[model samples]
Target: MFVSTPRTEASILHADLDSFYASVEQRDDSSLRGRPVIVGGGVVLAASYEAKAFGIRTPMNGRDALRLCPQAVVVHPRFSAYSDASKAVFEIFRDTTPLVEGISIDEAFLDVGGLRRIAGPAADIGQRLRERVRDEVGLPITVGIASTKFLAKVASAVAKPDGLLLVPPGGELKFLHPLPVERLCGVGAVTARKLHDHGIRTIGEMADVGETVLVSMLGGGAGRHLHDLSWARDPRPVHVGRRRRSIGSQRALGRRPKSAEDIDAIVVGIVERLGKRLRAAHRVSRTVVLRMRFDDFTRATRSHTLYESTARNDAILGVARRLVAGATPMIGERGLTLIGLSLTNLENDDAVQLALPFDADANGALDVTIDSLRDRFGTAAVTRAVLLGRDQGMVVPMLPD
Candidate 1:
């Protein structure tokens, strides 16, 4: 096994942007500061710290969010702007350490173990990182410093909305045990509910249980996984290579009203292009995520994960189209201003897969033929029948994480 350096100091840092979309709104428009700002009018993409004070949170339905905070100002998403900010901040993260793991567009784990002499202590480095993001990117970021990834993430969560927290080495348990069991990564609402019913509300309480018992409670793998996390035993490193967990593309639509056929065409266009890109990367993804923002400035995401991974466009598009169709009612209620798709839970081409079935006509041979034509001639050389003259969306290059 590969062993890392001794965890004598809190060397891992988890830096996360604060209410990223909403923060950008506040940063650009001075009038929005100190006010409840909601990004995404139909679904809550992000809520400013001010709106959060009113019990507003992200991914909440826009209608419900407005009901909670009626005075909130909602804005449509600017993907280009958010993408630019993410690139700039990630540049800072790369500059901080070569070993930077980007968890999402807005958060990363930075390993600064060997930079003590050059960059001072880890906590100090974390503070300086937050400052750089605020000063350079015009965004507020919170950072957490600890000996392990799990503890670092928890520390950042505890110190939210532009705060820096450091969990001292050897004091990880002291800091972690008091927190709720839900603080453990991967423990969602259902998992937490199960744990709560069993009287395991806090990490400390959960840690007191035997591993075998935890396995019995949360299934073997999850039980052991949570058991280790509750004990602050995360050994994962800040994986280098900036491998993004998902690859996505989106296009912004103006306030023009679109018919269901028009929307479906955009979806088809996006998926056809994205599928080509996925195969080029020599990877297969299990999840197809559909993200939409309505003219009402509300956003919502629907994702479907396939049991077996596949790189074929037809297979991924099949899943993508279904997710869009399922959201049709919501689309009718709110006019969509943006349409996007992301492929997640990726795996290597050689990974083992289940016996999920696909139509025999949807073969890699045909996909390879189309891709070859597109490569030699250009994307416009081979067009899906649905995208012809239908205002197919642009495929802009996403800024590197």
Candidate 2:
């Protein structure tokens, strides 16, 4: 006689801080308690739950946010304070489990599979983790427990604003099916529109439509991706110390109109910073992408793949400028509000063929020299003429490289 073994229990916990930046502000200032707070003047960086109740959201124009919540208190971002709070919260996460995988400064996926023998059930562990974050860090955090990372992330999203939810081991589909199709990963605005047009309003509905039809509608990769997730088939583990695949930075250009020169300068500043970061991480990129957000809240992206991977700032900037110039027509029609840059298709520097004397990156020597100076002195020790006398923009905190 043959017997079937029991499946693994739900042990993945996705913990995400509740309105991280806004919560930090409320925690530090008693007077701000229960008040609608928006933490940015130009673009809404973060909005407290109180503010969110009034339809305020991040990346929305601050003026529009104020129009929505007339009583909302506007405050400039304190990136340093948010960073400190994130560090403190991460410390708490590390103390909870050695199997913590940080997704970002404000969120992480923790695997507590074997810890149940000592720490009790995954649900209990998640509850305790939330309590610890609340009591120690003085920040509200939501935790989702499930057998898979995808389900855990979805559960956390559903249980937002300091809440916890668990999808029992055999009940993944029951918990997932009723949710809207937009809940699935990779189902963005465009994909969601397509799914909705097909009358696939829920995860269960999408699943019933079957993979073949989905593939035709959403293309091969994305169609297959959603089909797998609808039935809770994600196999990604909580990766610890994961290296980032891409390094990117963006500047929020306020409602004010920007000239082509102004946009180019911002692109240069962003690329300069990203280049230094890429080299510092000992990584090279083969693709450069330029992202633009319009006043109408729509976004467009253009990318160019290089003949070879390189981390030289000038080389990356050249590609970025070309991408931006190509998008110039769209920017003119829509009116640009934000511009960002990303270097992707990354590989370890060790994989790069050593440059010969004749084929070396012309700026490679200068790039390394400037990086060294910045490391010994400060980042401000080196400067580019285009970036000079311009706001470099705030350095948003990120997970470990």
TM-score of each: 0.74, 0.91
What candidate 2 gets wrong by more than 4 Å, as runs, is 1-7, 254-256, 295-298, 359-363, 375-377
Model 1: per-residue Cα lDDT at residue 68: 88
Tens digit per residue, CA lDDT, model 1, 270-351 = 7777778777877788899999999778789999988778778888889988998899999888888888999999876766
**CA lDDT of 378 in candidate 2?**
92
Candidate 2 lDDT (Cα, 0 to 1): 0.88
The candidate scoring highest on lDDT is 2
Output the TM-score of candidate 2: 0.91
RMSD to the native, candidate 2?
A: 3.9
lDDT value, candidate 1, whole model: 0.84
Candidate 1 error regions (>4 Å): 1-6, 242-270, 279-312, 315-401
